[model samples]
Target: MIPKLPGLGPLAALLLAAALSAWLGIAGPISIEGLYRWQNLLAAFAALAAAAIAYTAAMAKVKLDRQISDEQLMRRSLAILLKVEFAIQVLRQEARELEEKLGDWKNKSFKTVDLAISEPKEILEAWETLDLFPGDLILALRTLRASLVLYRTDLAKFDSQVEWESTTLASIKANPTSRASVAAKLLIQQSTDTITALRATITRLTNLLNRA
Candidate 1:
């Protein structure tokens, strides 16, 4: 079992050493007045006890300092983890909402769809406002920014597909020739394929943002 300190500081060790030295001086069988024996013996015992007390005090101080350092480090680490968790949760919620809007737009008319992908900017602003550890917040912010970029790229692709599909539909309606109809149908098929690919990419990115 470990020896527990009754209290802090070197007072206990000093008292213990003083008591032991006094006991030894009184009980030991060494002679006195023979070549400056009694005083010398007491002095030697007191010196030894002082040394022991000093060593104990130094060791206790070291242990206390280490304990304080460890506690400070643990607290800092926990605070960083909490911040990261909060940022991740916010990003995930935003990604979920974007994913739902994208899914809804897949089957709806492009004129009826209003894609507003602005929450990532809000998340980044909120993250910047937080009092975070030096580099940790930057790492999270970079990841969120990258996700937003990918989301924007997908959104742009979807927009282009809508434009291409609309142009193709207008051409088919204006000129009903068999050749024009076949060309418009082909363009429509290609636009549909592009939209499907963009939707899949959006879903994958959203999943990644959610899991982050």
Candidate 2:
């Protein structure tokens, strides 16, 4: 329902006064000078009442508009946070898959390299967009991003050190003393370390976000 304007009672009173003044001017035994003075006074008061009502209504509209804008911003922030939360879970799943692949790294078909060398942006980007209502989530986001970046650096180094020819996997199994086998072992360790670090970071972050 539309709210009644402020000072409705006073506006009604002014209208009643004007009507009474007009009646007095037409029917009552009042002097022209007195009636003119009274009408002028009522006119001035009416104008003031209108101004006051207009100002009040304007202020109310401004306040309502501000409230709506704030609500929109909060919804957007929350949506971003939820997306980041889901992305974090995806990271955990991806890390688990990497762990499984590392155990079977000797297989030619298994993948140990090709991991992205860049930091994950879901957390950091969402952190930038959020209002940080929980506030401590900020630290969690920063820590996670830093850990991922550091791990990616090592992963990238491991990926670069080896030449992934078809003989790479066969040599690791047949001639375990070759340079390719040693490089593959180092990559297995690196991949393991990265997954462990990421699991720890994700654990801490999950506790913060879900309060679990």
Candidate 3:
């Protein structure tokens, strides 16, 4: 069975008042002038009551709509945060893999040491679309984006160096005694350190998102 609605007692009272006013106008013993005045007064009161009820109903509707809108926004934020967290995990894994690859740089050239990482396009897009509520989470996201951009910039520079090294150091061959070999080793060490730092950043971001 449908639940009875609340706040309808006043409506019933208003209807009863209207019915009584009509009856009084027709059959009450008061003078004609007094009866007319009473009717007019009742009519005015009823109109004011109706206006009040309508205004109350409209306010209730607006409140309900705002509640529904807030819920939708919160759900959307959570969904996007989950996706971004997953992407951060992927980035963490890639950072580890790149670190491992760096260890074998003795056998591979900078060209072969390709970290094979790319921008987290989906995460970035979701971040742009969402407005996370928690202040800490928002700050964490900002830091994460900044870290990602810095990492990418570093990678780009590494790639540019690799290209130049490939052409300039081609004749050098990077033998054990060559200065080029030592420089390559240093680059490998630097790349490993960068990957470690990137992994740490991912971990921090993941923790922040998890808290959310």
Candidate 4:
């Protein structure tokens, strides 16, 4: 069994051992060659002790570094998750505005629908950073990305319908016989249907992301 020197370091233990050996040597008629051999053994023991201390210190340092690295990675992931949450809130605000805009189709603005805002930048930015998330979470981000594409498509179609409506709206309003008004209403209804579907998709996806 190895001896445990309480409150004594490697150097202190080695010194005590040397002192004990010297006292023993004095008790007997010590030869010079025997004393030299004992001194050499003590030197070899000290070198081994130094190497053990160094190895133990190195292992401790490695453990500390790995722990710190893991903590930093976890912290970074949490920050990205927070950004995603904030981006979702921004989308919900934009959704409220979209609801108001699509509320009435006929009294809607004569100008073309701007598709620029259909792809919300905030959500996209957050979505890009979700690569670090789990596979299921990454899939949710892809679904949201697809939804945005559909939203943009709806906006583009809405813009085209508005352009077609504007040219014939005034003329059709004057003539009761023209079928242009009917066509315009059909176009509006189609876009409205798509927009309605998109609203539900966004809500479901938002809830899904929140749970994730």
User: Which residue segments of model 2 deviate by more than 4 Å?
Assistant: 1-32, 103-121, 130-134, 159-212
Better candidate number, 2 or 3, judged by TM-score: 3
TM-score of each: 0.43, 0.55, 0.58, 0.53
Write one digit per residue (lDDT tens) for candidate 4, span 26-132. Answer: 76766787778679766866776677677767887999998777666655665665556555555545654544443446543444443123444655675666655
TM-score of candidate 2 versus the correct structure, residues matched by position = 0.55
Candidate 3's TM-score: 0.58
Number of clashes found in candidate 3: 0
Candidate 4 accuracy as TM-score: 0.53
Q: Can you tell me which runs of candidate 1 are displaced by over 4 Å? A: 1-31, 106-212
Report the lDDT of model 1 for residue 18. 78
lDDT for 101 (candidate 1): 40
Error of 4 at 124 (Å): 3.9
Clashes of each: 0, 0, 0, 0
Clashes of 1: 0
Q: Candidate 3: which stretches are off by over 4 Å?
A: 1-33, 104-109, 159-212
Off by over 4 Å in 4: 1-33, 104-117, 120-122, 157-212
State the lDDT at 147 in candidate 3.
Answer: 56
User: CA lDDT, every prediction?
Assistant: 0.46, 0.54, 0.54, 0.52
The C-alpha local distance difference test score for the whole of candidate 4 amounts to 0.52
Q: Which ten-residue region of model 1 has the weakest summed lDDT?
A: 172-181
